[model samples]
Target: MEKILVVSSNKTASETLLDFLRGSFKCTPKIVESAYQAKVHLNSDVLTELVMINSPLMDESGVEFAEYVTENTTANCILLIKAETAEKISERAEKAGVIIVGKPFSKAILYQIVRTVDIAVSRSVELYLRNARLEEKINEIQTIDKAKFMLMEYKSMTESEAHAYIEQYAMNKRKKKSIAALAIIDKLSEQYL
Candidate 1:
């Protein structure tokens, strides 16, 4: 489930937002009356995917908090502000990756904005995971290459022989090629160095 945080000071606005978000997204959002409270929640280890801020929060205008969220967390932020102020700050907020929504917006508009942000967040996470896997694969390949080189230099084996040795060892032990490479490296290093 996506964790959402709503920061608003007005009782009526927060209640309306809670209802709309709960009804539309089918998720419960944590509501905080001030940026300070929101920060406390955000600082925790739990990952929050979305942050919706109603402008004129009791502590501040909420733009700063929106920027803070964008800078500090992976969560997508939507800042609801007066139409006039939104126009003035939209560029700045957008540069920081915060989506600005003008006040007096219909439930449909809010839903659309949230949906768009959700799609963006999902894509971003997918890309991040993909990149991490690629990096891990690259590291494993490098480790295997290093082990192969050590075998060629210290064991007086040809490149093909080193490769075959590692492959045979991995198959025999039912372990990954990288794990076998690491074991070879440890044994050769201990024996030679």
Candidate 2:
């Protein structure tokens, strides 16, 4: 259900680009004859998730369109350019926070590139979340350790006995201590929900 955009004046180029991308991505492209028409699509297609602009468009330059897209859309914008312009296009895309897929395109290459980008984005987001959780876990460990130490120090209970009591309390209540610990952490943390 992912939406894609293709701005190409040449029917052959549009078809070829679609042929390569469709084989790999679950993509529905808004094809247009010129970059100007692409601008219209960009404004209206709120659901679009990606853009592929082929250079040499009838109405506008691919680089120019890519700039506009970066300014206007949250979608991942990529360029389709000839080998000679590959470096140039990529430099611009990089500055615009987009990526470029070089022309003489192949289905395999497109598939690999798209898959890699998806994985990288997902992994980065995951790591950010995991790191935030790790901070919470560290605080939880400090609290639980204090609790365990209190039983040994104040009640004069052996370390093993204190551990057993906590385990039994946790089991009898049908609740994991880790879950309780996380609840404590959540209460302390300023979460939105």
Candidate 3:
């Protein structure tokens, strides 16, 4: 389940939001009365999927905190402000990728917006994981290549010979090709370099 963090100074509003989120989404959201508390929670290792801020927090207007969450974390943020001020705030908040919703909104509207943000966060996480895996694979390939180059230079072997040697070593040792390459690199570095 996705984790949610709610930042609101008003006790009544926070309770309402908490109930609505729990009932509608079947998830419990962590609530904080100030932006400072929210920041402390955010700094923890736990990953929050969504951050909902009721504007005019006791410590600061929620806009700065909303912007902080969007800029510094992977979490999606939604800022709720009075209808009169939402338009002005949206102009700046939207640029930071913060979703702005005017106050006096119905549960139905909030539900729809939350659902949409949930979908977007899910997709973003999938893409990020995919990219991380690709990067790991690329790094492994580069490491193997470096090992092969070392073999060619220090052992006076051709590229094909280095490749064959690493493959044969992995087969004989019952190890992965990358592990064998690393071993070869370490051995050669110790002996020659």
Predictions in order: lDDT? 0.93, 0.72, 0.91
Q: How close is candidate 3 to the true structure, as a TM-score?
A: 0.92
For model 3, give the 10-residue run with minimal summed lDDT. 85-94
46-80: candidate 1 lDDT, tens digit per residue: 59999999999999999999999999987889999
Candidate 1, residue 188: the lDDT equals 97
Candidate 1 displacement at residue 153 in angstroms: 0.9
Shift of residue 63 alpha carbon in model 1, Å: 1.2
Estimate, for each residue in 72-178, the C-alpha lDDT of model 3 and write its tens digit: 98788999999888988777987999998998899999999999998887888899999999998888788789989999999989999999999999999999888
Over 1-193, each residue of candidate 2 has an lDDT whose tens digit, in order, gives 3577888888998898787777666666678888888878878877666777888788766788888888788667777778778776676678887778777877778777777766765676689799999998887667666556666666677878766766776677677765543443354343322
Candidate 3 regions exceeding 4 Å error are none
Q: Which structure is stronger by lDDT: 1 or 2?
A: 1
* TM-scores of the candidates in the order shown: 0.94, 0.58, 0.92
Show where candidate 1 strays beyond 4 Å.
Answer: none
List the candidate 2 regions with Cα displacement exceeding 4 Å.
Answer: 119-193
lDDT, candidate 1, equals 0.93
* Order of quality (lDDT): 1, 3, 2
Candidate 3 — which pairs collide?
Answer: none
